[model samples]
Target: MNQPWSGRKLHFVGIGGIGMSGLAKVARSLGAEVTGSDRAQGGHDARNVPAGATVVFSTAIGADNPERTTGAPELHRADLLAELTQLKPTIAVSGTHGKTTTTSMLVHAMPGESYLVGGEVRSTGTNADWHEDSAWLIVEADESDRSLLKLHPTIAVVTNAELDHHTTYASSRDVDDTFAQFLARARDAVVAPDLTRLRADAHVFGEYDGPLAVPGAHNRKNAAAALTAIEIAQGTAELARELLATFEGAGRRFEVVGTANGATVVDDYAHHPTEVRATIEAARSQHPPRVIALFQPHLFSRTQREARAFGEALAGADMAVLLDVYPARERQEDYPGVSGLLVAEHAYDARPGMPVIWAKTHATARAYLQRALQEGDLLLTMGAGDVNAIGRDLVAHSEPPGR
Candidate 1:
């Protein structure tokens, strides 16, 4: 378990992003020099970006203010399409939801350190690490516009197939077809536990005899895929199950902040339909008292695609709080078609147990929760964006039971 790669150079396109930054950190740990450019800079951009890696600014930088970037990497972002076209490296991870978490898991679990593009590496306390002369270059392959198909990973792991990036794919089948193409590029494709056919030509990795510690059944599938990928990468499945069982899971992936006033506050980054369903089901598996779900929809397009699904998922909670959509990278103009209120209305009709409540902002949502939630309730603030902040604030302000 000596550090795999101990010296090299790596660069990232969107280093400020959580997934991107996590990759940078892992690369640095492998002993590679790291540098990155952010469209806009934030606290995540300017602070603790490894010791030697330079921060470049990109032209995609918007007016968001907090994450401002210098103009250094402006040309780089402008010409990234051409630049990445030429910069060849080793190993790239391609997928949507589990890109960061699973990439990080593979980086930590697998042998032969790698240079990750947008994966979390714990050794360097950052994302996008650089290792020396390593055969592995782990990257999160985004399926937007079939971009991931460009990558050539010796071993590829597909966590799950879902309809994402509506701005790109026309339909769910298109997304799957694109993924099928990506799988075609890999020498060996690591598919989920239940997938039987898996595009025929590619080799599918099998599950070992072991139980994963990760909460949800979805994670169990993720674990199986990761294990398969590791087996392909390192040419050994030895101790893989042991490593998987010890995994505590990534940050904000159903992370429990603390308990308060006889209630438990759990935070998770579950924005998509499949993710939301898995997270809530995991909460229910624990059989917690009165599950209180505080959900903030992530994107306008996503909300529209899965609003009905979202409603059905939230209905599982004993009490649910629905906040306005968090439009992080998208614009408000796109959201009028798919509002959080619409999602709530649909979910209300579907579930007969606890009613889904709507709030315009976090303040109103938190206020509603403060009044409604009592002892023995599990308040789960779940989303991919900033929704976890509400759960943190709630835990901070609430008093212990009988205090």
Candidate 2:
């Protein structure tokens, strides 16, 4: 069957974004002429855009963007997924956390299954893939903008639920209710036992005792969910477990960027408090020595809502460095008194014995980390924002130990 997007010229406004880039790659793979632009300098550029292409923009792109004024028909990323789900047997993974990891695992277990994941699968080197003749399609259903509701998957996987995206959800209950609605629409689902809204055919799974390449108990739970989905798809769980044991994990999910001064530098996308705690615990399990964490809060709204919780999570680290808030799409002026300092203050109050340093800028934070990081330590750069760059830069600039 010919792909519906074949012969179409597509332009993505913010192609550098994780989700947008995934869609762009899928479109290109389907034989569409694809080009893109991002405000950031290094991503897609104007030179690559074809003449008279259909422009697609995410919510982050402003009306004033040149591509937005091109008068091309606009399509949201979610709209594309909705159209695809209508045509394929979709398995959508939706949750407040572990969605990417679970989706990647399913893709690994079932070879040749088309997928649209939010992060790059280290093994595959791309986030999204197109298999024109495949019967199944897997995706990371995002709940941040309530976009997961648009997908109608044959099977859904909800890892766990928590209150996030303060702008979309009114309360924790609202978040849970939204997830329940998403699951209700799916033909079948595999969820964590704690989710508790399973259908007759739906399955609930707990931790797996089998060996896994990824660290942490949470990953064990993710592996269990993936195994259940594989079983439902009529695949062998034993084979899946063997494949999972060799999985290198998705990018930015406990990715080991490099090593410096005898300490391993890890980059992780963990913004929520629950995620933060899990990532830190994973680092401790691997390193066993001092775990030095440098966290840059992702959004102002999230920081304002979960400052105390974030502080408590950071306290688990042997030493914590709080960088300035990334603020993604929000203006700093709109959310006053919401910054790294707020988290530092709360963490100090909660765990006075553990040291928390508030470094308001990247320069200060980098200097502090260089001086503080020593042998037998794990340096974890954690957040949902661009803080991952700091870890890469630190490794790139540092000399080998004993230089």
Candidate 3:
């Protein structure tokens, strides 16, 4: 009962991604045949690919990964669509940001057998599996490049609508238009607080007015949306509050490491502006001695696009340390002259009274904090990349010299 997958063949395109990898794990746990493909030099194989199941992959496969070619399955992302067409699933999860977290929550909360495909593995389960008699099919619906349109789910959840992926959309309106299409695909759609602006005849969730177990008002809304989706899809909310209350939360999303030398070090995988604001606001609610943040930007285009907003969000912290941008699969020139310094500069403008933010290498950022930190300070390392190491290293280094 704890594991939902019970032996179905599941194949994932972009299997190495956080959301995709999580779905693979949920599927494999149900005893389904799980397989996956990833771009060349995909990182984190141990986390992404399931232990047992045939894995056929190629970064070069493109959209051609799913077609059966002379008895061999095509190794492309689109080829998986053909495969999905052949195997009609029960449920799918799709969204830009909160898909992984929400899908993981649903997998953890829902009872009975289910099949799931998402971008990351949330719980301690196999990376991918197959299930024959799943009550539902769970997936992370991504709107980037209209990839989510490929899925037709009984229920769809849009975490929130934000101005992201400037590389594709000319404006935020374009992003909204795409999401409206995604909402149209599902018989019912569940959306969070901010994303309510999207034009969808979809079902609404997360509007329940109750004190939430998760920190931040945003998470409360996320819980509500999730509960609503479950109700519409499964015919009962079924321990929704209890499940949300018990969820310790996925890794690296507000994960608190041990306190050392009177300083508390926390880490989160918040890269976008809204997420940054929400996370900082949550930390502020803790009534800590002081909040000190060390942030690593995720991508060049993202940084350049949201530099001003990023500044406004981070200024909420009492103190700030900005690190170099973490450019995943991008060239440095893609964002020339854009770095963590810009964020610090922008933050300085927003919070003039707060100490001017500092920019440092990961090592130097740690060293600066080690020298300046005081008792009762909250040190947060925020990013979607290796910046998490700063929090770990900071905690290790921040420890009282002897202990």
Candidate 4:
């Protein structure tokens, strides 16, 4: 009775990442010698990766990273995830949208299970948990890196598919084809209505009208998908539905921070145009007097390619504030003339009379919001970057429970 990774030594290159840290923790739980280093976590040799320890790296890790100099064998993060998935009955959730939320929902609705989500779960306050005796495992399968293909799960759920990774697949059809392959390899699958045809044995979940603490039509769809997978796993959905009734949601997915300058500050990890639009619409659904979207563009490539689309999405909000492109791994020098202002201008054009402001920096954005917010208004901050910090700063003076 040995774990698959028992006695193996693994070093993660960017261990500070949410996903990488989760994998490292899980590997350690399963009996691996796990060491990791993040440049931001102070420059140490990842607590010293021993000789011949296999180095595990993600797509974001570069070739020149010091960890790769160990001269040891290398493993992709997906391969490690595949190893973990094979250890138990896995319920994998993948999609262009709703993957994190849906994966979190499954973890919440099912008890006595070990799970890992790409984003931290609000209830658990961590991205992963390891239970030595659990009968099941829940994973947030990532389609962004095309790594979902590496997993072979007992049950798979694809909330929906669309082309958001500009650097990965060439077109939406390529996205679909990849999803179809992921689903085909699963023992059973629940997919979006449009994707049921991708896998002959795939299932389309029934419409969910159940009560949920999370808002949005898209989340309702996500709930339906999670419920369907739970039924497939346990042979019934009633209990799962009961558990989901009070689900609080994962971090940064419509998380309301606190009252800041009379406006309620909400933070979300909605980078894609579709997600942005959905988050805005979901906020509006709660009957807030107004939904002001303060969005920071994540990447230069994505912002350049989808500026207009993002603008259109922001049009769904009552007012829009734009911050400069975050650049992430992409350099601004590589893509000239692409900035958040481009999207702000496009947003203004999309809605002839709507107001749009390009704050250009977080400081300017925060100052403007402080002067502009009003009671009954919801200040929603959306992005994949460190934009949530601004929302937190806005509500810094507020007491606990909301901050």
Candidate 5:
């Protein structure tokens, strides 16, 4: 099954990244010699990379990176993923929010298939796996850089499409068009009812009226999408529905850290306004006395473009704390006058009486949260960055004496 990748040597320049690490695991299991390096230097992640291998990198790796100048041939990450697609009938899941969870659901429902997901699958304890004897490959397709267009999937699944990457796509229409093109290239497509406006001929997945192991109405919809995709590719959803009930979901998709000070701490990767609102709404299902949202806005452009929407989403929480914009791959100087306060101010206006603070520093944000959180409260951290560490710390400090 891994004919082309057998015995091949591949070194990942940024192996710690969820996508890269998942890909590396699958390639290794398929008989590729895998090695990896990360910006973490000699830390645990970098030290764990195989001793030596030929260079492999992604679009995120700059040409000036020392690893890129090794004079050895290198492979693009996306290109490697496309090669895997050639050997198996691929089920590619792409959407603004639920792609990771949806892909993980499909993999968990239908076992013994190669899979590459952006986040760790809770049930499997890993993001990607390889099965030489399986006939399928499940991938969490990324649309941020329009890279999802490269793979030719046997069945393409779109949970829903929206404008999330402000830089890559100029408008929501561009996002829709890209998804339409993606669906058009697939042999079959299972899409959200909202997406029918883009591709009517594509199968319109019905909402699953069954129970789910995961929380959130949004997750129920994701399950429906996964089951529908399974039905299309395999002609049955009977067993898939049962398996999905055991699905714990992918990491950072409403993951709960232990309780801290009698309050539950949950973490989520919800940078967009829609995701933020949905996650908070899901938390409300726990029926906590109060929901405290600790959010770190991801990009300057997104915070600027969706500040009001972000505020509206935050209003769903009982109280909210906003950390400064996390300028990932974007410089603060380039985004002058744009910061998390933009959203915080809007949040303040959304509910003048609600407590909303814009903490410019992570330390201050943590301190504020530590002081404000109370018993019976639920702390839900949301971001695309490392904000989950804060929730973990809170849980650690509140743990009972020695284990």
Candidate 6:
């Protein structure tokens, strides 16, 4: 369908972000002329920016950004979503984790459905798709910035509630309260049974018995949530189960980047302590010879808040390698200690014989991993930040053992 922004020129600041890029792609698909600039040096310049284009940006972009200072009309990603939600029947998938995977599963179950997932779906090679004929619009609702509160969804699905994003919430109670508010706004809702504090009438999903292609018990829960959401949307649960059985998984959620020297390398976006533990458990369930986990802590605030918990979670792995924090939008000076050091100290304290190594840089970590990985080992790169590159680089540089 033709959106109101069709035929208009749009430019995005911090366009490299998954959500921003998804919006840009959808706008372009709807016939809007789209361009964007990121912090990537020399990636964008005034020469390429179209004159009088509407400038769009996310919370991550700063005022000093060259593209943002162009004096063009500004738009926030949340504003765009708010507008779109008003126009169509919306289904918002929310939670501290599994938002991306569950949203992708829902989209996969309903072919040709319009969706804006937080991460790329490997099966589709894109994070967002705009289907003109479909009346439904599915979005991965981000609770970090409380943007999910802005969306007026006809159906809302909460995968699970947890205390993260300390910047937005003061405590776990605050997080649960905000989620309750979001759910209250929805006409119908589906949620994990653990989140029973919210209204009980909401469809609560438990363990799914249907076939699943993705590994891990968490994925089964994700599938169950997706199936319940599909049923709420008037879709068949059986078909969704069948599609989920063949689901290849979304990008960076236990994504097998490649294998080298008989060792399988997997990458996952699991930065939180709970997520880290779950990902480690998933790796263990695969019964690999050894699971060597390489983790990069995402934000300084998060690391500061959950350092001990992060260390405890890393104990689940046979061996652990910690990389310096990614510090996405935070300044290092603002935080007390380096995330890697904090996690390393606590991890060693928690698991004395677990063999934890603090590789302060990518080069150091790569070198250490190359020499350490043995045949039949499962090398897992876990984090929400750029640590996924480690697995990709390993895959690109190493050859099969027999080769």
Question: Which of candidates 2 and 6 is the stronger one according to TM-score?
Answer: 6
Residue-wise C-alpha lDDT for candidate 5, range 70-163, written one tens digit per residue: 6767778887898888889999999898999999999999998889999999988999998878989999888998888888899999999889
Clashing pairs in 5: none
Residue 397: error of model 1 in Å?
2.4
Model 2, 291-343: lDDT tens digits are: 99899999999999899999999999998999999988899999988888998
Residue 365 of model 4: what lDDT? Answer: 90
Scored by CA lDDT, what does every candidate get?
Answer: 0.66, 0.86, 0.67, 0.89, 0.87, 0.87
Please provide TM-scores, in order, for all candidate models, with all chains considered together. Answer: 0.79, 0.95, 0.80, 0.96, 0.94, 0.96
Q: What is the C-alpha RMSD of each candidate to the true structure, in Å?
A: 5.4, 2.0, 5.4, 2.3, 2.8, 1.7
* TM match of model 3 to true structure: 0.80
Q: Give a tens-digit lDDT track for model 3, residues 177-246.
A: 8887777766777776566677436666655465454467666666677788888866787677676666
Model 2 TM-score on a 0 to 1 scale: 0.95
> Lowest-scoring 10 consecutive residues by lDDT in candidate 5?
43-52
- TM-score-best of 3 and 5: 5
Model 2 accuracy (lDDT, Cα): 0.86
Q: Output the TM-score of candidate 1.
A: 0.79
Taking the tens digit of each residue's C-alpha lDDT, what string does model 4 give over 1-403?
6876788898888889999999999989888998888878875363356786899999988767777766779999999899889888999999999999999998889877999899888877889988989989999999998999999799988888889998999999999999999998889989988887778778897557989999999989999999999888889988898889888899889998988867899899999999999999899988988899999999999999999999999999989999999988899899999999999999999998898988989999988887787777899999999899889998985443333
**Candidate 6: residue pairs that collide:** none
* Candidate topping lDDT: 4
Worst 10 residues of 3 by lDDT: 61-70
lDDT of 3 at 370: 77
